[model samples]
Target: MKTLLIWCLPALAWAQAPAANPPGPWSGGLGVGNGLEAHATRQTGGHLLLLGRARYAWWGPKSGPGSKLFDQLNTRSRQTELAVLAGRSLPVGRCRAYAAAGLAYLLGRQLGDYRYTTRSSGLLWGDATYYYAYRRYQALGLPLEIGFQGPLGRNQQRLGLALQANFNPERSAYCVLLTLNLSSWGNRIK
Candidate 1:
């Protein structure tokens, strides 16, 4: 009985172990999706990013006049991102799933009210003030995504959906995107 058990254990382990390098060619794709996201920036009302504060704070351009004295404060900002990635794909039932990680860049801007009073030529210059809601920021981050795709029509193109996250030193952002991919996968999974 002991001899039989030992032989079967080795066989089971070998069959269940995964390969070091799976069989597939490296594939790439481009996707775009919108989700509730947040970013880190050097502006007022940009900190204390706990809870759900990050999603609602930075979005769209601020409204109102850009004057020092009668200026209106803006509590919102906007962010735009682009990423490039490469990875492999595996078949899951009738669909193919892939995971990729690479670099991403973000552009952000905000508007705010500013008031200043200074001395000019040794005289009180209370009117020496100017304001414009202008703040722009840029950041680089690592982005990872996992998604599933299937054939699109008769061509080698595929349409899929994915969930992605961007990791950086400042903050982490997430999204859910619809993806379109064209790769070397061919008709292997059909």
Candidate 2:
């Protein structure tokens, strides 16, 4: 049994290897739609990449019996995250597809109790028309993503579409991103 296991280990490792090792450099991508997404991908070896990503989202309150400055449907709660991810890409037809998972530091910020105040003394506080608040937050998150990539022009430029699911101790959501790569800055072997 031990000899059989030893023989299988090498086979398993070989099965996971890429058909070809394509050395790559650090490439940056910017994404839009369903929030903002940005990443820098640098190839460590073969199809492996180190991805640094950043994202931001918003959840706003509606008009609710108050006359605060934000009551005009022009305000939002801010949520932002930053992460370092590792991914692997494989060639599929004319494109390359990848999957990545990472931990993110998230910050959810917004006003808690909001109100409008009049300078007129103490006995004139009213209920149905004011806004006041403090900031709220959720600190940690995990993000999982899958994406497809295609070349754009030259210089290792590419375009990508990514789908992501973000999980936090307090909140969770899904987002889709359309990404544009500017250039590969890390690998000089173009």
Candidate 3:
């Protein structure tokens, strides 16, 4: 029995040798989106969002901007964030639906104009000042995301879209993003 098993092991190893095609579980991509960020004080505004992302697998650990990274909504406001997440992915027809939750760091600032009239030399004149409606705050955040990606062609490239929400002690934000990824997910062997 040992001799027979040893003889079959060589054949099994040969059969399991590397194929012409390779599997690429790793993925990286870029994205663009729009965000609506609000403060606890009820100051809400829209921002143009930009992102960069990289990952290992849908159901495993990875790093990169899965949703958004930069927020330069207007001259009066700006924000930046980075996150680390744990997630799961599920098959949805030809697409994969994924969800992740993790910790993030948020840095944001906002400036507003404050104009008032003051009396000087018994005369009243208009005076202009600026105030931080939302003062610059850098704090920890909780980010949650849900999205899907699918093949773009016969190649490893894919197109994805996701909706993400960020919760922070100072503010919260919601974003919608579209991404393009290159992965070794579903490819034909030569």
Q: Best lDDT goes to which candidate?
A: 2
Better lDDT candidate (1, 3): 3
Sequence-dependent TM-score of model 3: 0.55
Candidate 1 regions exceeding 4 Å error are 1-32, 35-76, 110-135, 183-190
For model 3 the local lDDT of residue 44 reads: 11
Clashes of 2: 12
Is 1 or 2 the stronger prediction by TM-score?
2
Question: Backbone clashes per model, in order?
Answer: 1, 12, 0
lDDT of 2 by residue, 1-190 (tens): 9999999987655433442433356678788877898888875544646478888876556444333444433245667878877778787875678888888888876645555643334567533334457467767778888888764344455667988777887667577888877554544554
Look at candidate 1 and tell me the lDDT of residue 139: 81
* lDDT agreement with native, every candidate: 0.50, 0.67, 0.51
Report the candidate with higher TM-score, 2 versus 3: 2
Between candidates 1 and 2, the lDDT winner: 2
Q: Report the candidate with higher lDDT, 2 versus 3.
A: 2
State the weakest 10-residue window (summed lDDT) of model 1: 43-52
Tens-digit per-residue lDDT, 1-190, candidate 3: 9999999987655433443454344445565666432111000122112222222111111222121233221224455667666666666665667777778787776343333323235346533222223467787888787777763333445567877777888657667777666544434322
Candidate 1 lDDT by residue in tens digits, 36-102: 4332111112111111112211333233433333332343455555666555556666466766666
TM-score of each: 0.44, 0.64, 0.55
